[model samples]
Target: MSEMEVLVEVRGTLGRLTLNRPRALNSLTAEMVRVLDRTLSRWERDPEIACVLVDGAGERGLCAGGDIRAIYDAALVGDPAPKHFWRDEYRLNTRIKRCTKPFVALMDGIVMGGGVGVSAHGSVRVVTERTRIAMPEVGIGFVPDVGGTYLLSRAPGELGTHAALTAGQLDAGDAIRCGLADHFVLSDALGTLVEDLGSASADDVDTLVRRYAQEPPPSVLDTERGWIDECYGADDVAEIVRRLQAAGVESARKAAETISAKSPTAVKVTLRALRNARGLSSLEDCLEQEYRTSCALLSSPDLVEGIRAQVVDKDRDPQWKPALLDEVGPDIVEKFFAPGDDELGLSTVRECDD
Candidate 1:
């Protein structure tokens, strides 16, 4: 009914997309998701479209996240928009991953939550020194969706779990080292890089990107890999906390504190989802599992309470129902993953023989 929030254009052989809501830090709306998903699908089959390049309109970032205020409002009023939005968005994530074209994502700023959805599945993700990437759904009483479980589950060591628990931002180097991003380019050089890629033939896109990619500084994630793996790779949330507390390093202490303050259900479910994701065969399957868990959590009181405290009231204090990890039993965790009639209907998985 309204204009699309995303702008699609063609420059030479590149199918270009700019997120148009800079005033809102390019935070995604349901309309934005629909438009982006459809555009990528269309461009995938066009012979004239060599690749798709996506970036944000503003300087602040590519995308902050989905417009959670909408979900927060609907949750408060018992509306179903959040449910429908997540369903469509998850399917779109799958489409981006499976698309035939080379999809380049400019993740130069605050890439988190739903923003991660649109770009993490790209064929090539470019991060700059300013890249501040994370999957911070736990803060809002949700686990990572939009194929996040798949991405995090595959990250080097336990870096993914640490990010999930802490909602910490990763730099360009860290994003590359941790596998969130594939290349690092200097912030000032992005425009020229975009031009080169835009004008290159489809076959030359990779070469053009390599020509512009700069060597990233060393990654703290790589340096701290041992600590992250030792702490987050433990049995469960409680075990991870206990280990971090026992370690007594300032970093470990801070990590423990962050996990301690997050929603208990979100923490435990996130842990389970990450572990489950490690064993899944495909991104589509991980998304299916995430869809089930998301729908279940959306129906829970804690999500609404968390949104009310964080986004609506600005209280910074959510009275979570199962306030402790121990209180959230396996039954509660399993309930979120249980089969249901409203299961997200993703398209059939496309496979290629090796």
Candidate 2:
């Protein structure tokens, strides 16, 4: 009954949560996240709700990301409230990751940043040919948050590191190969699937997912795998950049250039976060670390500068602090991972199998 930007509807025993901001490609808002968190929590305890389906309202599909415009406004005013946005958003992310009942995310198209946060952790992730997934946070001087650290850290070989730093977009096939999505179906089939899921019991839902699912093909970026692994397998961001520059492969060079253009401080901290996250046992642990890093990022010069160039100035030219990657020392990167006394530890949830 509360005013909502996101809509939650219960159809029989199935609860459907739709991201309703189509004009912005369903960009997530703090209010939307709060509504979803409350609704999901209700469904978790309600005996009538057998399962939940998350999808976006528009033809473009699920979501683009968090309302960066809001974050940008806060950054301009030097307001620290944006950190609270991440705190609540991350809580919702972890809740979805650990939901007891089956949660299916219909990832139809243009799923990125916050979109990845909402869908990637679900018990069932369905992708279509229309799906275009990425974590482009680096472009705006931020690391991938919203539980991305947990998912990306677990990716095969060095794919996670490569994707994290490059902010590359992955098509449906690539998404499946990277273990970002669980099932592949045509975009048009999603409606039918949702209808089937709504009337189906737990056993029936499993059968439907399996029946409609098709094996994902080789990724379009498959040829770049060797280069990605060799270059990104380094011990730190600096070395990774060096290796990429040395490789001379077009993909590697392009990736290096992309990193070079970003906030050097963000690159250093993001790489270190991904590397440190590799040892964390669960998504919750990774989210907690990401939350701390994100809060610290709000105060950093790079975040504001990056946003200014890319979003405000529209100049596509950012004067990053610590302009060179080497200037962002290891000590600076390490500070983001240091425990914050006020930070909430990630929930101890059941581990997800990739």
Give the number of the best model, judged by TM-score.
1
- Give RMSD (Å) of candidate 2 vs. truth: 2.9
Model 2 gets an lDDT of: 0.84
Q: Candidate 1's error at 4, in angstroms? A: 5.4
Error of 1 at 277 (Å): 0.2
In model 2, pairs of residues that clash are none
Q: Candidate 1 on 21-54: residue-level lDDT in tens? A: 9888898888888888788877887998998999
At residue 215, candidate 1 shows an lDDT of: 90
lDDT of each: 0.86, 0.84
Task: Give stretches of model 1 more than 4 Å off.
Answer: 1-4, 347-354
Model 2 TM-score is 0.94
lDDT of 1 at 127: 90
Task: Give each model's clash number.
Answer: 0, 0
